[model samples]
Target: MSHITETLNQRGNRYGEFNRHAEITQNIKKAMQDSPNWATLKPWHREGLEMIAHKIGRILNGDPNYDDSWHDIAGYAQLVEQIVRPPAPPVPPAVPMQNPMRGAL
Candidate 1:
């Protein structure tokens, strides 16, 4: 499995309960909807990570206005993972090369 998939799975296993928590889920959705333009404004990959880190720090620091829960953090991390390690492209089948001099040999 890929690193991103592994990380996501591990997080899911660890915090699966929050996935079903109505308040947490709603908070995550609200946070995302409130910041719709952040992704477009900060197009750089690193900028995205920094933004997530900033919000996480706010939560850790007990910022009352920043109501993002662990679920929100995980969602942001998953987004970053998707951006950093996108799915691999499908491999094309190999074609047999004809040897012009094979019969001539």
Candidate 2:
């Protein structure tokens, strides 16, 4: 076999995992949909979405940067975190005031 053919076969072996990238993208979308609010997505949320798109594009184009063994979906995780609410602030609850006229009734 030609050296070129050998290299191509090895490279093609990694393409099988391309679908995983698509799966990650789908999960990201689902997370976004499940979010209660869309108006207040943080900057990192947008960045993660853009990064996911870039990663998918890179994988589809056979970019050499993609790792075949490691399915790193940090972008998806970050986006989901943004979709979820931040931790609530700790504060004392306010008690409702009872109407004074109720005693007279």
Candidate 3:
């Protein structure tokens, strides 16, 4: 088979695996929505959780060893944290920038 054809076939298979158990993903998200705190979450929080849930579901249905899904989960959670959590206070510079020549004769 041609290289392009082989690549396309591999992609198609991955898509197949992802969609083969579509209900599983939806069920996971549905259960999450049932949580009492779900309503209280900010929109971004809900989105992040849902995305994480999706990656989780995919991992469950597909390769358990897949590293990308884990990274994706962390990325989504980080994005949610950025939006929902308060920003950390800025740290003071250890040494403030100054003109060396300012005090020089």
Candidate 4:
């Protein structure tokens, strides 16, 4: 087997546990669905990302308990990408300008 394939398999095995965690998956979905608007979603996403960052900082500072930060980070990143997708904008109708020189000096 190639090095890349081995690394991928290892990561897949490690991260696959998160998929099997019903509570985590449900909570992620609930948090995502509870946000009413993009304004609210942005803050929630930022908070999750910040949490992951904090976890990383702790691990870097020698906190072994934060080793599972990758799972949280991946979850949050996936939520942001998957659930926070905005709806398509409504197309505005084109209107002909009555005053062609409206902005002329």
Candidate 5:
């Protein structure tokens, strides 16, 4: 997921340009080899790790892309959109100690 996070961050900075998941996966594999802690990542987590790496790559390389292409990438672009262009109004914070079944309409 770190890879995904990194890719997402890059995508936001670059304003969405590239979508190289394979290269991202390679980076993630290298990262895992370098850091022993990466062994704990589950199989599912490893699934889209490349996508995340793409984001990191963009960040490292600096966002050279324009804003128009940001929405074009496949795989978790919506999450990227949220980071780049946040919703108009953030959802209201939940009330403390709110009963789960209180609103029995």
Candidate 6:
């Protein structure tokens, strides 16, 4: 076999598990997109979720003990969370109401 062919075969072999997990991940993503909240997500948030979902597939597909895969999911989520929605207007504190009975007593 040619060197190029050998390398390609190895790469394909590596992807065998990935291919199965990826199809499952795609279905997961589709379900997420179907939810009403999907429209509210920023593109960055959605992308992060997609990447995290892929990691989840890896974890669930006979590799639940893999630490880095879990970390990768957290890392992706953190990246999106770091720049999540714009700041909300600061809420004003309520003024204490003076009771009329206080002075009348």
Candidate RMSDs in order: 13.1, 12.8, 5.1, 10.8, 14.7, 8.6
Pairs of colliding residues, candidate 6: none
lDDT of model number 2: 0.61
Clashes of each: 0, 0, 0, 0, 8, 0
Clashes of 6: 0
TM-score (C-alpha) between model 1 and the true structure: 0.33
State the lDDT of candidate 6 residue by residue for 1-105, as single tens digits.
999988866644543465777787888999999999999988998999999988777666646776887899889988987797577899999999988888584
Error of 4 at 92 (Å): 27
Compose the digit string of candidate 1's lDDT tens values, residues 51-75. Answer: 5654554453344344455667667
Estimate, for each residue in 25-69, the C-alpha lDDT of model 5 and write its tens digit. 467668865786657865545444545565455544455354332
lDDT against the true structure, each candidate = 0.58, 0.61, 0.80, 0.58, 0.55, 0.79
Instruction: Assess candidate 4 and give its lDDT.
Output: 0.58
Q: Which residue pairs come into collision in candidate 4?
A: none
Off by over 4 Å in 2: 1-40, 63-70, 79-105
Number of the top candidate by TM-score?
3
Instruction: Compare candidates 2 and 3 on lDDT and give the better one.
Output: 3
lDDT (Cα, tens digit) per residue for candidate 4, span 35-62: 6653555676766655555444434433
- In lDDT terms, which candidate is top? 3
Using TM-score as the yardstick, the better of models 3 and 5 is: 3
Worst 10 residues of 4 by lDDT: 55-64
Q: Of 2 and 6, which scores higher on TM-score?
A: 6
Sorted on TM-score, best first, the list reads: 3, 6, 4, 1, 2, 5
| lDDT value, residue 103 of candidate 6 | 59
The TM-score values for the models, in the order shown, are 0.33, 0.32, 0.70, 0.34, 0.31, 0.63
Cα RMSD of predicted structure 5? 14.7
